[model samples]
Target chain A: MIKTMKALIQREFWEHRGAFIKAPKIIGIVLLVTTLIAYITIRVTSAKVNGEAILQSGILELKDMSLENLILFWDGMFIGTSTLYFMVLFFVMYFFMLGSLYDDRKDGSILFWKSLPVSDAETVISKILTAILFVPIVYSLIYFVVLILLMIFYSIILLFHGLNPIELVWSPAQFIKGTLVMFSGTLIQAMWALPIYGWLMFCSAWFKKRPFIYSVIIPAIIAFSWYWFKVLTSLQFTNISVFKSPAVYLGHAMFPYSNDYMGFSGIQFNDDSEAQLSEILANLFASVQRMEILYGIIFAGILFSVSIWVRRYRNTT
Target chain B: MTQMITANNLSKSYGKFEALKNINLSIGKGKIVGLIGPNGAGKTTLLKAMLGLTKYTGDLEVMGVNPFKDRAKLMEDICFIADVAVLPKWISVDQVLDFVEQTHPKFSREKAEKFLKKTKLGKKQKVKEMSKGMIVQLHLSIVMAIEAKILVLDEPTLGLDIIYRKDFYDNLLNDYFDHERTIVITTHQVEEVEHILTDLLFIKDGEIVLDSDMEELTNQYFEVMVSNDNYDDAISFKPLSTRKIFGKHVMLFKNVNRGELEALGDVQRPGVADLFVALLREEEQS
Candidate 1:
């Protein structure tokens, strides 16, 4: 089973190299170029002013900032970059999950796949693993590499300005901690979004045409119609609103670190108080509700089973 | 002889239409069985049932496994090329080889690569980048490399030129088929596959009209070509079907003795394509 799943995951990567490899590399290149252009512009502008005085003042200002504030600033930069990465990641995975099964069927390649020794359940599970585990892990690794490249660029700039690169930038403890935090945060976010991925996969397997319509538009319509029906009839059929309840849950789960849920109140970058960064990370991770995670897992499990069932019986031309 | 496939009272339907009606068959190992039928004649339905690609009622087993229930397990010893163009168009040849090698315990990557070396296909060429003929060649190479007990081909040479089609069958017979392997195939070009088939099945309107071994077919059925003067006498034997060719009347007889038919006019064994048409015509008339 592990062997088959591993092969299946490799197959996914082969098919979607553009999304898994090329897109992240392209993003990295674009970011590096933009940073280089900005650095050159800064150097050109700083040369017009007294370069030595400006560099000295910048060094003084960096020295004055507390280590906690520096770590926080870097953390914010990491989070900001990750936010952009996740936004692109979401669309890439969403469309990939939506089209993965449908494209095979449409092109009549599903029959070839079905001829293999692997079961339909195995195939679907491999796809789920690819979306939830492989994509994020690969993306994070590439993002880390890009982050390191950007840091090297920063170190080069600092070296030119007569600042100690090791002292001002490369804090080993913080870097390792931040890397761990990014991976854990991305994984948790994936778990939170499992239901959506499951739904898209189910749609991909089941729908004959236009999986987007069936997955997204149909659900939206059903939810809205249910909402209006409750309002007009004034009868409480079910305690849970089909759409609104999950929508609210998804909103909260997606933005766990939002101020409304987990206000960063305890972590102070004050000169005297040395806030433990681990505590802040723990608090952020804890803000995700246990109940919501449970529900998400249950929902995702059911959808994944349905997707497997669909794959078993779906006949492609 | 070991039975490769057994079906008893196997039937399939779609909505109000029945695609297969109580099919009962047992195909033995080492024989090439050709499934022949017209369009919508349940040939594909039966193949799909056997391959576990479709659900069917009644007892059906492939290599002693209930195919629909344990398709994955059954597929380990069975390989199929449902069509010539079923491989995903985006995958490169090397990737396909890698996947098959990794997933299939019986697949030989070295053999597949060797088979591909004979073709003009490059290892890095994707399916979409190759021509239709090359794709079929690539598919055949991969399929032949798998050490399977049963190999099913459904129109495996569809849309190929004569050279490629002939080459496909040649490779199947020479490189793939052996004493231990059984082959079940369906094709619109009955005559093309007729020479290679040891057993023949004729389906019409979701029912098997005729099922017989090639030797049995030769002994039991004959086509008599009678001139205008002998045509009236030949008609009395109740031929399955009759059609005119040039000035002679050709009548197909299912069970009439060859000696008896020879007394009417020139008699010979009918080709598979001709026999198929005659069987379907007989079924419709009945």
Candidate 2:
């Protein structure tokens, strides 16, 4: 079973190399280039206004910052970069899961795949597992390359300014600790995002064509109908629950809210006060409410079972 | 001999149209059965049932396993090429081998590599980059590598030129077929597979009109070429169908006297394609 699943997942990676591998590399290049251009433009504009004094004062301010503040600045940089990566990861995974089960059927390759010894359940589960586990880990590895490159680039800029980057940036515990936080955060986010993945996969297997439009339109119609029904019957237009629920689930997906320092509570509550790292981690872990994750998982299980059953019969679009 | 496939009163319907109606067949080991049928003849539907691809009523078993219920286990001993050029176009040749090698326990990567070496296919060549014929070649290479006991092919060579189609059968005959294995094939070009098939099945309009071995089929159905002098007397024999070629009459008959037909002019065995047409025409007229 493990062997077959490994091969099946490997097949998924091979088929989706554009989204999983090339997209991240492209995102990294774009992020790097834009950041470099932005920094150079700011340096040129500020230098044109005041020459070397403005640049020298910035270094002096960095030199005067306490190690605690430097670490906090470093944490901010890590979280900011991580948020970009996670946001792109979510979008990439969204379309990836959306088309995963449907593409083969559309192109008529499902006939070839069905001729093999693998079962329908194995095929669909491999795709779900790819979305939940494989894609996140692979995205992180590529994301790490971008993160390290940015770190080195910043360290070089600090060294050019004659400041010790080791003390100010590289030596901080936030680098390793931030990664651990991202890992745990993503796993939690996977659970949080399960219903979306399951729904997309079920739509992929079930719909004959245009699965994306169907996946969106089905829920939209349901939510709209509920809204109209409530307004007509009870006239309670103030408290709307239908749209808020889906929007919250989709809202959680676009934001990496479970990562330390990314959450609002993880940041400092008081103005001009140093944020404690321990408190940030605690807030990050605490923000993940257990009951919602449990419900999302149960909802995901039901959706996925239907997807597998549909896949067994629906070989072509 | 052990039966590789058995279907008893098997029937499948799609809405009001019955795709297969009361198909009863027992294909045994070491036989290459050619399922010859015209369009909408339930040939594909029967193949689907045997492969566990479609739902049908009544009893159907392949290798003693219920196909739809235990398809994964049944697929271990069964292999099929559902159609030509159905492999995913985005997949590279090396990935195909790597994938099948991992998932299939009976697959021999070495055998696939050996077959691929003889062709111009490179390890990195994706299916999209290849011509239609090359894609079929790649598919055949994979099928040849697996040690499956029963192989089912539904129009495996539908759109190929003459050379590729001939090469397909040549490879299957010389390299793939063995006494321990059974093969079932359906194709439009019956003449090409006539000599290769051990048995013949003619399905038309959701019914198996004729089913027999090649030897029995030839012996039962005979074709006679009669000169102008013997044409009327040959017509009196109530032959299934007749046509004129080169100022001589050719008539096909089932279970006719061989010596008496020799006296008319010349006796010959009709090809599967001829038999298919004659049988369908005979059934339709009645």
Top-scoring candidate (TM-score): 2
Query: In model 1, which regions exceed 4 Å deviation?
Result: A44-69, A171-173, A229-249, A252-256, A259-280, A314-317, B236-238, B263-265
Model 2 agreement with the true structure over B150-201: per-residue lDDT tens digits: 9998899988899999999999999999978999999999989999999998
All candidates: TM-score: 0.90, 0.95
Residue A35 of model 1, lDDT score? 73
Mind giving the per-residue lDDT tens digits that candidate 1 earns over A1-317?
88889999999999999998899888889888887776666566677787755543432345556777767656665656665676667778888999878999998899999999999888888888898889889888988898898778878877876777777678722666566655665677677778888888888988899999888787788787887788678867663456555654454334333323222222233353333345435645774655666788899899989888888876535
Q: What's the lDDT for all of these models?
A: 0.81, 0.83
Model 2 local distance difference test score: 0.83
True-structure lDDT of candidate 1: 0.81
The complex in candidate 1 yields a DockQ of 0.72
How good is the docking of model 1, by CAPRI class?
medium
Candidate 2 chain B superposition, TM-score: 0.98
Worst 10 residues of 1 chain B by lDDT: B277-286
Q: Score the docking of each candidate (DockQ).
A: 0.72, 0.70
